[model samples]
Target: MESETVTKRKTSNETNKKTDSLDDEEEIGLKAKMTLINGVTVIVGAYCYAELGTMIKKSGADYAYIMETFGPFLAFIRLWIECMIVRPCSQAIVALTFSVYVLKPFFPDCQPPDDAARILAFCCICTLTFVNCWDVKWATAVQDIFTYAKLLALFVIIAAGLYFLLNELQDPVKNLPRAIAISCTLVTVVYFFTNVAFYTILSPEEVLGSEAVAVTFADRCFGLFAWTIPVFVALSTFGAVNGILLTSSRLFYAGACEGQMPEILTMIQIHRLTPTPAVLIMALLSMLYLMSSNIFALINYVGFATWLSIGAAVLCLPWLRWKQPDLQRPIKVNLLFPIFYLLATLFVVIVPMIASPVETGYGCLMILSSIPVYAVCVAWKNKPKWFNKSLSVMTTILQKLLMVLGKSNKPAQV
Candidate 1:
């Protein structure tokens, strides 16, 4: 997620400042090249995802592709880790970033109180959750409006990327690749120039030392108008949170449809045609994670898991080709793309383990923890009828309360 890296960069900047001091010209040149390299690297994954998305035609981006190609156990583990750690933590961290920036102008010469920021973050999450749950159209509308808002902001700052919501596209197989190509190209150009602008305007030391790089850039260039930068960043991160919620809820809904999650999650509100249960559950989990002081640190660990899951999914591109030779492929990518993407994901997953063993260990432990959960809840399918009945009853009551009908019920189209 772009939002994941946005939060990760804050802490990383402090570390870079302490560890490496370089001359301004050398620093700017090095950082510019790194930005270009990073942009190219992301394109590889974008291609891989575009292929998998068209091939699978499912909502849960990585999870859906992995399940179809790798089978249930691995997919379930990915789903579990994503729901429990990656998605929620990423959302919370971004929400915190949003809150901080939204409150920045108000605080002016000082930082906002932690409690106040967190409270606002919670409200942001809840508001978006409601937007997601009440209607799919509403969620996308929020994504679109703020996306334009952020684009205008990015026009000012210059930066961005896109993914998820492929299933919602009318002609994903045809449109997906085009969207990826155009968006990735635009993002790559914008991000590279954005960094160039940063390096050109601010000294290397300032770039490395600042908490919010964009805010610092604005401080340097915007003068008294610097306050507008915070508002732009706040809008940017706010849209990011909505994008994450809009997509992550689909993972939960997809898991339910696959029988890996409670059946109720597969349901949609009758009137709204939205996955209310899935959205609410995701929102609740994100809210819980907001209470953790280690939310930023957890990004390091979850980054490990996130890349791992994505790597596994990308591997499926070739696996399915070899396994199911004649499966309908709306688009077939060259084998080289997935292979290169897998190598990139491998580098991503391994570097952290060597550099940050404790964080990597936590990520590994979290992935392994899903094993017992899968064994008990998923693998053990022969539960007593009473237990099954109890679940069905609860699902029924909740369905009534939420006014949702399971996908299996196939409520008539309006």
Candidate 2:
């Protein structure tokens, strides 16, 4: 009887172990599916926005028109805030953030690295510079190829995620909701802030900066796959960074052409037809930015300004729709889209403002500094025709205000 009982117990233990293994596999599959869904959502959203912006420009009103309608001072402030301060600072912050994560394991106290690590860091910077200065077209093509690969990789990851989530279907409802809430909150905040950092500091040459999405994923998956992940991470991030550099430089080049900035900036090399000068200038400035310890603080300031501009743009959507009913919108933002964008923008603006007093103070000063620069460009140079129209509108508004006060019929008026 004792021998029989021992055998039955051993069999039951083996069955339980097999069941647990199956559950683990199912959980992983579910998690991958969820991740894929998230990835697709992002790709679709980005494509829509990019296409929409291009369509708007093609319709009639270009950047100048937008500037004229929005106040030139305000527009100039926005441009300066984005191009000069925000973009460069944000890049430095991202590099710093990644450096922190990469180096943390080696140094428990998070102290500066010793000579060996510093040497490695220097080598990385040199490599980054080489990548930036290489043939623009080739770089762009490479980036495109990698971007598609990254997307595919993300889909695979998502599939894995979904598989894992599905396997956990028997989990309690409260646990699931809590997990979902935490996951969404983390993804939204991290994704949004990281992009915010990218948009603020990104230039043509500096593109995606030090850390790519692949690098981020690799870091997360380090324990599971070890060295394999690092190789994939390097390839994925390098491609992403290259793409970012191309897009950013183009934005600056376009801005320069709009007469909102120096016309010299619009100049491109005839041979390459690339904005080599702008790229060089932006890269040098970004490198200088890297030396500063206060880089992240500066990024916070840029974040505030960037989000404010984005919020203003989103708010203007409703106004634009009502004011220019006939304006062709190839892709209209859904009502809910604008609302959520606004709320997100508002949160970004408020959070940094409340958190960093010095940054807020410096941001205000930077904005004021743009006024004199805009004045000189408008007064002496061949200003865009819209500048006159804007001035005329302002004069009309001031005159109307005076007339209203004058008609009040007080003794002081007599």
Candidate 3:
């Protein structure tokens, strides 16, 4: 498996991927990998490849960084996989989710029209593409506003939960003994992920989305603010989509500028100083994905694919140490750290596949499916002349067409 630095896709105020997580949280049953395996995985996996994330920051090019530690072929394959599948599909997933949330508020009584929602999702991607292409500053401003809105909404939910818990349970510690007993069963830090799923873990029904929470709250209490949950969810989801659009486009742009992708992808809008070509490409790919799959499918696929890169990166840590002994390290860790993480990552990835192959197998295939494309990309030099000519022609047309976004177009600085 090829790799990148980050596996967890660190969420912050700026990236509230709460929409997808809400669905995961709603899943019923306490079904999980054995407690022993899961517990060790929880601790070892927390900092998995964190050092490689640092390496990428220090080295600047994720692919180039990997090349320094490993070789060009591996780096190229990783970049190829990322640019071709991971990013676009990811953007599409987010837009699809945003569209679902956008329509959920109004269609509370029924399922959203798939065709209509797909169209709306496409429009959302198009709108965000233009937002990114119109100007970098304006795109950033939109992101900032959404980030704050997302955070505020998240805090509101948390505060509301805490309030309800306090009011309902006069002896809040009443279950402390039972909790401790259950905790003893898990026996260690493994409860980290399981603990978050505590509420829904044992539930029998599916946890489709945070819609469950909001709906339940409305049915039981807080009727006055019931409408607010849907509204805030829409806002937060929109913010997440915008943030992902901005970042994912930049990543594609950077890959192109570094020559890992076709030069046509290097275009920047002169009028707005933005990666207009990359932004549009992302939108096109996202829309294609929106037309094909639903939210949960995308989520499962993305999560499974991400771990491949993450696992590969963790495996690089020891190699990097010997390969670049003099490399400046403001912070360092023992070899055992990354080794444990690598094993933990494998356990996390493999155990689930074994436990529920039907669900995760498709995602694993999606990740591996990049290999054929990667072979074509890296072996373009050996491709037939006619194919090369056709590719060149398409590239030229796209370059000229996308140049409409700029007055004095320039290649990305890197």
Candidate 4:
């Protein structure tokens, strides 16, 4: 009973994992070239991230890859947009979903509690922030355990699903049109990490258009409880939240550490050995986002924005290669790779306009609107007095909060 809980909870059905049975059938039925394209897309993405990471390593600055490739102005703009808007919106969506899935299993009617979900989401963000403030080591230690447990949970799910499917169905179900759809579905599942973390079940509405294959099969074959799925879903999504929180906070702290942003954001708790102020700031922004937006609506708005940001960064690969040909690259993906990659990404960004114009337009507008704000906010020349003063005050507040929570309040160093 306990083992099968997660399979019942997440309805979108990537957990369906659809087996290699589906993929083998799809390959035989669909044109090999089509499957080849989707398969290569995944490979290219993996290669691209590796190339980007190498650039970051060789450059030795957190933002150096962008700065060296695109110049300081573009670098500053990317920093402002990412830190101020993109990461917060993303983190909020993750937090909200974490709350929804965590609360969902108890409601067997499939109707999750919206008010409770919202409150819990808000509290989850705050609690994570509070724990990190109290002690970074303790918070990370807890997160590490959850991270492993998440992997174990996923292993349990896939293993169970596969065991049942393999034992019952020796032969693959081959259907031509279904092949194309499943292929696309598989690609989407692998492409978007957030899919793991949903309002409407995309697999049912968009991919399978019915009850998930795994769900129906599990019911008929194993007669498992309907409640096993959400727990594992929650476990994985919670791990994702922890990852997002830690990585995003580090971006801001490192930005401040490099003098790219206000130094107050750089405040580290000596006792806790964490960036307490930056963590709190991100949590507060995440809380604000949760208060304001609907989960699906936020996902829609962020989809375009995130892909745009990612595309911009990915496009930098060719620049880094061209400008610094002499630079030691751990892995070099050719110029043509990024060229094709950019076109592929352009299609991804443009598709939203055809499918959902209003949401995608608003998203693009939100990203574009950052330009003038970037102009005003980034002091490429001299530090503004008010900016410095604000940092001093915010730093003191963050430092005092750290002390009040535990350690003696000596002047906190940024």
C-alpha lDDT of residue 336 in model 4: 71
Per-residue accuracy of model 2 over 17-94 as CA lDDT, tens digit each:
898666654544444455555544433333334323533562212233346346566666667766676665554444
lDDT for 336 in candidate 3 is 85
Error of 3 at 182 (Å): 29
- Candidate 1 per-residue lDDT over residues 155-272, each given as its tens digit: 6765321111122233477787888878888988777777767776777777776657777777766788887777878888998999988887567778877889887776788898
Ranking by lDDT: 1, 4, 3, 2
Model 2: how far residue 300 lies from native, Å: 1.4
Cα RMSD of all models vs. native, in order, equals: 10.9, 15.2, 14.1, 11.2
- In the range 106-159, model 3's lDDT, one tens digit per residue, is 677776778877888788777878888888888889888877776565555556
Query: Which pairs, if any, clash in model 4?
Result: 5-228, 5-229, 6-228, 6-229, 7-229, 9-229
Backbone clashes under 3 angstroms, per model: 0, 33, 3, 6
lDDT scores in order: 0.80, 0.52, 0.61, 0.61
Which candidate leads in TM-score?
A: 1
Model 2, stretches more than 4 Å misplaced? 1-55, 58-65, 97-132, 145-225, 230-237, 333-336, 379-414
- Give the winner by lDDT: 1
- 255-356: candidate 4 lDDT, tens digit per residue: 654456656566566666777767777888777788764665677777776667667777778766667778776666767777777788798888888998
Better of 1 and 3 by lDDT: 1
